[model samples]
Target: MKHIPVLLDAVKDAIGDMRGLRIADCTFGAGGYSRAFLDAGAHVVAFDRDPHVANDANMFQNKYGNTFRFVPETFSHIGEIDGLFDVIVFDLGISSMQIDVGERGFSFRADAPLDMRMSGKGMTAAELIAKSSVDELATILRDYGDVKKANIIARAAKEKLPQTTFELRDLVFNPNDVAPVFQALRIAVNDEFGEIQRALAAVPNKLACGGRCICVTFHSLEDRIVKNTFRDWTTPPGDARLPETCPAPFKLLKTVTPDDGELENNPRARSAHMRGVIKTC
Candidate 1:
């Protein structure tokens, strides 16, 4: 499956046209934006926890050898990143490549291993669920998946906890309930929320003045965090007593959605919400 970038034109405009600027794509899934930025004349350093992508780096590097670099690390560790990034993009959550292929275990649509590691580390979803307490499973269903019948889901999940992809499908949820359960397990296995939180904390310090950070989230909960952070970072006018007014930590820029054409072609594009923050102070 081709990884057609969501809001490609808007992302280009939001990142702005800058010369010799350093841009970071935290989720360099299929080299969609990284390739585009490099083409637009910027130094691009992309990150992806999945080392598997590195195997294909030769393809991109061969084409754009001098300017492109792929860092095999999560975005949350931006503190360790060497230089400031002008436009730091966080396209959080899974990509279509993972979902389309079954071996990676991201989907319940086809059969594969129970593993759902975005970084290809940590316990597989099957192992985690099989060994976890019913309460633990219940919490995962409720908090991560937001399944209405979390307790029932937990009971079913626990029963088929150590199962492979199809095994768990049969044991935990019927065909209808499968998707939600799969989503919850995948999020927990990837620690998506925790990583985003850690990555967000480093943004204010990592970005240069007037630099922008664009984040596209696939899930409602993830979008909620990004929205709240953008709002809070506005740095409202407070403490009028201070000699000089404190500048806003960041400026909330636009929230963009893919056009209806794009959404109709790629339903995955439907749930996507893109927002940005620009450093103003």
Candidate 2:
């Protein structure tokens, strides 16, 4: 299935009138957000760790000329970029193309090597399972996936050390969701939460005055991170009794979710939420 960007219209609305604006498309999955920003007359620098997206990034560079730049790196290193952007946007989590491709091992429907690394680097899901103890695996499953039978599944998984998607999926006992187990393992393998935290940390420094930071998160864990970070960014410091009003460095923007029409068209967007904050200082 082709990748459909979730909450795209809402994101565009959040950044209103992008002409002559500089945007950093932090996730750049399938280049959906980048294309939309460019089409709206913005200069876009797209970043993605996954090498599979190079072809798409190349297409953007070729088509948009100097208006578009592709950075073949993770968003966590966003601080290293030289320019201050008018907007930074993140569409987090795996793209549909990754899951659809059976060889990527993001989905359990196909029997493939348990390689869930987004950048095709670092620890593979198979290696993660092999190295983690039953307790560690149980923690990952519980924390990331919210799996009910985390302990039971973790014990079985650690003992078997499944090297393929099918092996792991079959190893999961009945009445437990295999999807969450895979989700937890994939997040751990990619260090997704850590990546998100680091990328957002750079936003305040990378954004120009009055610039905005936007994030579209699909799951509660990531959504909570964005929400808390944005809150911190927009909250004012100092004593409340001073009466010397100290304005927050950033101001929170409206939160958006998929409308009925979008949900009908893309069920994957049902869980998506878009939150944004504008730099006030």
Each candidate structure's count of clashing pairs: 1, 0
* Tens-digit lDDT track of model 2 for 184-267: 999899999999988887788888889999999999988999998887776666634212222346788999989999999999
Off by over 4 Å in 1: 237-248
Sliding window of 10 residues with minimal summed lDDT for model 1: 239-248
Q: Each candidate's lDDT (Cα)? A: 0.81, 0.90
Candidate of highest TM-score: 2
Top lDDT: which candidate number?
2
Clashing residue pairs in candidate 1 are: 130-161
138-190: candidate 1 lDDT, tens digit per residue: 89888887877889878877765545788777765456667888899898888
Estimated TM-score for each candidate: 0.92, 0.95
RMSD for all candidates, in order, please.
3.1, 3.0
Candidate 2 residue runs with Cα over 4 Å from true position: 239-248
